[model samples]
Target: MWREPWPSSNRMPFTKKRKLQLSPEQCSDFYADQYGKFFFPSLTAFMSSGPIIALTLARNNAIAHWKSIIGPVNSTKARETHPECLRAKYGTSDLKNALHGSESFHAAEREIKFMFPNSVIEPFPSREGIEEYLSRYVNPTLLHGLTELCKHKPHNPCVWLADWLMKNSPNKPKICDGVTVEEAE
Candidate 1:
């Protein structure tokens, strides 16, 4: 299923651009599993012929939305049906379609991995999960800190609260080996 990024947008939310020229062998390897044996060679040659821009688009239903904007695979068909589309406006034929979009979420993930090996794709957290995390780890500690701050009414409340939280935190590391200053009698 298509996974939308957190904080939904009406438009494309994120774009990462990579400019690279692929060798024919690299192109062949890239499309090996996607295209058939007969179609692979030409597709590889065309892809490797010049420099290409690889873009990663992130938003709600990005793949489907982009595909719609680019129009059909055949430029001639796109011209007839969707004259405003990128392929219709720029492409000359089916194989020479002006742009390519991932067919599905799986294809998108696969293509992204192939194109950007170093990149990390993270799944968005569910709303319930986020709420649960806050409730379990944050609310109690924050409540205590806020209550103490209100009671003490420190001159620099923000700093005071921060220091108080740090000092009172169960997660704070203990320094057992540190020298203690003895009180003067």
Candidate 2:
């Protein structure tokens, strides 16, 4: 299912440049130290060369699913191996792959924070915990359009939630007492 794109466009002036330049040390910290300095400049240049999409997804094992679906970093290899994958079908070359997926949960969180500074995503939850939290808080708010209500009463979670549900519940259709159904002959 296609979800909404990033709230801000890549071409927008506010996002015209990379938010943080990864120093050689930082790059080593984030991406393994085995990658030499020679690789960093070209990688940075390629990344900054055009607009890129950042996705904020919520689901079980999203990192693994996305990485598998996109095939591999090298489009050519992906085409030869996983022809049905997204990169195999759409990617131009190894450097210009059609999509990017985080290597791990930590990487996903960092990338999401980098792309959307204002957004706050809690640490990844276990499958059971995620389902419970979604059922209790997230899904209801979305279904009832309680964003504004929550914003207004940010300090009081229960108040806005209760108000939102009470105001938005659907009315039942009136039933006729004398109506009876007959079995088909």
Candidate 3:
């Protein structure tokens, strides 16, 4: 999972005391009329009270897996029904559930764009095919290669990373196929 800075517009949804500043129409639109009116204020407040960390994760059936791990939307109910789930273990109540999972693949794509506007996420090949998806779409970049060292190899990792970055840094000029600024005209 990778962390991203929260969007500034999220702050407009609630008050300092964590009360929602939304109209009934807005609440319906946001929640898709799934939750009751009474819950909307607290739900919005909870979501907007502070900066939220956005994460990108990959796995077979990722959406379903993540939803299952988070359990029910109501944390108290999750604790009684799914004691092993993340919300059941860490959440205090429905209003304070600690995680959010996308409910569908389309929703996940849209949400990813909303959180990280410049992200380059490809459409999924198949929800059940993890290996094929990874091989086809998830090529290891310089950053990913360096990060993998901690898991696959840990000997002198810091030195290895420093050396790798020095070799790859764009500050050192190299021959290129594209036109330079001087030749563009």
**Which has the greatest lDDT?**
1
Model 2: which ten-residue window has the lowest total lDDT?
1-10
lDDT of 3 by residue, 1-185 (tens): 11124335323221112122444454345455456668776766555555555666676677887788678878899989999877787677676777677888878776666556687787656555876546544444355656766666767888877776666544455446874333221
- What does candidate 1's lDDT look like per residue over 1-185, in tens digits? 11112223323444676778888988877777856767677788888888877778887778888888779989999999999877787777777786788877888888888888888988767889989978876787899899999999999998999899888664555455695444332
Consecutive 10-residue window with the lowest summed lDDT within model 3: 11-20
- Per-residue alpha-carbon lDDT of candidate 2 for residues 24-96, written as tens digits (9 for 90 to 100): 4443444443366666655555555444555566666777877787788898999999998777877788766
Candidate that beats the other on lDDT, 1 or 2, i.e. the better one: 1
Clashes of each: 0, 0, 0
For candidate 1, the lDDT comes to 0.76
Q: In model 1, which regions exceed 4 Å deviation?
A: 1-12, 34-37, 130-185
Look at candidate 2 and tell me the lDDT of residue 6: 34
Pick the winner on TM-score between candidates 1 and 3: 1
Q: Say which candidate scores most in TM-score.
A: 1
Residue-level lDDT for 29 in candidate 2: 49
lDDT of each: 0.76, 0.61, 0.61
Candidate 2, position 145, lDDT:
62
For candidate 2, what is the total of clashing residue pairs? 0
